[model samples]
Target: MRVLVVSAPLVGHAFPLVPLAVALRDAGDDVLLATGGGALAAADAGLPVHDVAPGFDFGRIALRVLPRHPLVARAELAGTAGTRGAGLLFGALNDQLTDPVVALADRWRPDLVLHEPFAVAGAVAAARLDVPAVRQENSLFDGRELVRATGARLGATLRRHGLTELPPPAAAIAVAPPSVAVQDGWPMRYASYVGGGELPSWLREPGERPRVLVTRSTLTGPGDRGPMPAVVAAAAQVDAEFVLVRPDGRSARSLPGNVRVVDWIPLGEALPASAALVHHGGAGSALGALAAGLPQLATVGPGDRRHNAELVARRGAGLALRPRDVTAEALTRLLTDDGLRAAAGQVSREIAAMPAPADLVPRLAALV
Candidate 1:
């Protein structure tokens, strides 16, 4: 079977879908991954790929789109930006990518289309081709909310392509542990895939002290320096060694003695030695920490970060702090708290019990 996997121009969107694509490839299906920013990461993972949004960067799109759309601009986690506003914002994004994706799908003639939720282009293309489209869902964020919020915008776009409506997803490959996703989806174990990077030699070797992993979002805007100062303060308060995973073109402005920086590495690779994690609440980071059995402190940012932070906290595995409140005190609590670690371990066990992507491959044969 030929599979076309579509994703938005962001790694945060694409990374969650790669595992399933890889699994399908290994099962003798031809898999083609489509995206803009995440195309490199997918290629690095050995999947064949097509560019749907050439020359368009996720950062640039965020800057351009957010300013024009006030309902979504600086919208807090699910803030007053109702579904309609989110839907319109999502509609425009999907609309921008739809033509290219549809063009690709028309040529490829894929038997199945797999997509990260935000890439509604995949669903549209699948509908055009009369093929099944599946959602590889993981994040607490739901693209459906944004799509549903779109009202006539989405349908109108569909009508332009000779399509009157979008069909329901053939399946949802759920990866989030309970309490995170709004509804339970068909279970597919998350197959972890962080972008291409080598694990540092020092990180590989055993260490004397309990280590803590720290990271910031890679999708930062020009003015966004992120919470580096808070991380520095937290490092100073903790006795543990801090390994900061540096995002591209970003270096620590100031580093505490306990904090050391390394180039991009998979958070999964960093998890075993990590006693705890402190990070901006991107979906991948939050879910990765839980999968690894590490306690976390999610510094809430705009978008789904708050949803991720709140979900983990509700499950007793982590703490959520607003950006202003992320401090040494919070770091100290995350490191010292025994209950958090225990809860984290418990959730880790639950995640481990789910069916891996490879395991789910046979089930998808029917869909194809």
Candidate 2:
């Protein structure tokens, strides 16, 4: 079968599709990934790639807007009502949503289309081509409140184009653990939990001292908000060595004595050594910690971060703090607290026992 995978320009949106694409190729299906320039380099290595248009550089836009329009920053960091505003602000910058993907569908027609949830253009293109489009959600946009918050603006855009009445696609894949409960009302009939890519080579097993992992989401570009200095301070207070991974060089600034920075370290490699994780609470990062049985200190900033943090705290696996309150004292407490650590380990074991994506891939394949 020939599958066309449509991804957004952002790394967060594009990277999750990589493992699925590789899986499809291994299964003897032809997979072609379509996105803008943002993920072209990664796709070029092996996966077939087709550029939809010039990618949107959200980092540059954030730097310009975050200071003056705090709502823009909130939208960029917190996954709240602000995302609708950001989408509206940036949507006018490119018309690719309606044009490029539709044009491409005309040329490389495939049996099915796989798309990121935020990649509205790709979904529309699949609809236009009259092919089966499978929508993939990479984050925690699950409950009714979150759905209403994030989808309001995009829904309006579709309505304006006379596309409001269309039913949702054939399937929706959740790339997270099933423990992360989603609203039952979502349109998806099928949901699968897929973890992130394999672990990197540099990580070591846990030692005598507690180990903590610090990372931001890969989608948040270099200029995106991160409390690196505070991360360093927190590591110092906990007496833990910090292994920081920022895939896009977002956190490459001056480091403290106890902190080690890497451009990209696989979570699989880093999680086993980690007693606790300090992160921006992206779904992938949160699930990575859960899969590893590590507790989390979620310092949430933007979309779904707050929700993911709430889940962690509610489950008793960790503490969730706002960016401003993520102090060294809090970090120390999270790292040393026995109850929270124990809860995290328990949750991790639960997550590990759940069905892996390899099992679900064939189920999805059967749908086609």
Candidate 3:
């Protein structure tokens, strides 16, 4: 079977989707990952890639959707949870990929379309191509409402492709802890794959003290750069060492002693040695930390990050902090807390018990 795997063109989305695509590839199925600008990142990771929106920058659309500062953007979400912003951005991003994906699927004739849940373009393309479309869960919470919120717009777009309504996913690949699955699907074990990169030699050696990880979501573009400085300050207060992953050109400043910053490294490689992760409540970071059984201190932000943070708190695996409320003291305290580690272990065990990605291949093959 030939699989067309698509996702939002970002590191976070690519990281999670590739593991599943690799499983299929390893199982002797042909696989190609299609995205916008993220195709370059995927190609660097050694995946066969196709570009839909060749020059698409999600950050450009994100800045447009919430043009104000982070505080104003934060307040906008706080009001209606910014359903309008989410819908509009979803429409914009999907609009870029929809036609291109449909064209590629038409020429390529893929057997299945497995995609990040937010990439409505793939589902619509699959519907038009008459292939089984699978909605791969992108976050800890259900975002079906966002898709439904833009139903009129999405429906109108699909109409151009001769699709009257968007078809339901042939299968839904869910990696979130089952308790948090608002819309359950095939529960697959998360075979953690952050990127196709080699771990640095310095990272291989054990740190002098307990190491802490600080990161934010790949989707939080230029508009949300405010949190990085605060996160760096908080890490300075902690007695442990800090490993900051994927902090780009603009956000990589203000490093105190006992801190090491790397442009990119697989979380699977780094998490095993770390005591805990301090992150914006992105689904990738939260689930990745849980996969490693590392305690987490999540700073909640827009979209489902708030819900994901609440789940972290509810499960007792970590403390959830609001962006305005987070402090160096809280960072120090989370690093020192024993209970968080214990709670994290429980989440880890749950993830381990789920079916591994390879275990899911034969099952997905049957769908074809």
Candidate 4:
């Protein structure tokens, strides 16, 4: 089977699809990834990739589209309204990529077009070719709702592609743990892939203190550090050793003797030895922590960060606090709370019990 996979041009957006894509490839199917920008780095995983949207800057697109939609603009990427705004912005982005993606699909003629929820261009291409479009859920939010919300905004693109409406996905590949999010479709165990890197000696060995992993989202826009500054300020008050991933040197100026800043390390590799996590509520970070059975303290803010953070808290696996609410007390609780630890372990086992990506290969191939 020839499967064409589509994703938005961001690491957080693209990385989630890697496991299933690799599964399909190992099963001997022809797989090609269609994305651009930072997501193009997915090529390092050994899959053939095509840049469907060259020179695409999501921050630029967000700036242009957000102002026109005040509800989304003012929401600071929080709440249902903010998510709706994201749907519209993604719709606008799909408008730019539809023709190219459709053209690529025309040439590639994939039997199945599998894509993350935001890449509606994949849906358009599938409609244009009369093939199956499979929705791959990479986050806690439902793809169908997002696509439905985006419907009106997609009028022009649908018309251009000779489609009256977007087709429902023939099937779905859901990765979110069921307890954390009520995801639909075939349940596949989420295997976290944080890309490759040289591991530091400290990461390979257990730290002397109760180590807390601190990180932020990969897409925090220009000049926006999210909650890192707050985390840094509070780091001094916490007694545990803090390993922060990839903070700018300027942000690292503080002499917090307990804090260690590394340029990069794979979360998948680091989570096993860590006691807890503190991060911006990116889906990747939240899921990775869950997979490792680590309690989390997710700093909620704009976009789907709040959404992701709240779900973890609702399940008792962690705590969700606004950036301003993040403090030393919260960090302390994350490391030492017994209830959070048990809930996190339960969620981890739930995730581990889900079917592996390889188990879904036959089902996906059968769709063709």
Which tens-of-lDDT digit does each residue in 198-270 have in candidate 4? 7787887778889988887787573246567777789889888988888866668874888888876777888
Candidate 1 lDDT by residue in tens digits, 1-368: 99999988777778778888888899899999888864456788898878888786655555566677665674633433435444655567787889999999999999999887778889899999999988778576565554455424677678878877777888877787764555345786665678878898778654777788878886765323345557776677777888878843434756778888888787788688778888888788888999888999887666666667888998889998876687777777888899999999998988899888888887777886
Residue lDDT tens for model 3, 79-161: 32545656667677787778888888888899999987667888888888787988777677564665565444576688888
By lDDT, the best candidate is 4
Worst 10 residues of 3 by lDDT: 220-229
Cα lDDT of model 2 by residue, 206-281, tens digit: 7557767777755645324555556765555667777776633434556666777665555666667677888887
- Per-candidate TM-scores read 0.92, 0.80, 0.89, 0.96
- Largest TM-score belongs to which candidate? 4
Model 1 regions more than 4 Å off: 68-71, 74-86, 150-152, 222-225, 247-251
Give lDDT per model, in order: 0.76, 0.64, 0.75, 0.85
Q: What CA RMSD would candidate 2 show?
A: 4.6
- Compared with the true structure, the alpha-carbon lDDT of candidate 2 equals 0.64
Poorest stretch of ten by lDDT in candidate 4: 220-229
Query: What residue pairs clash in candidate 4, if any at all?
Result: 77-303
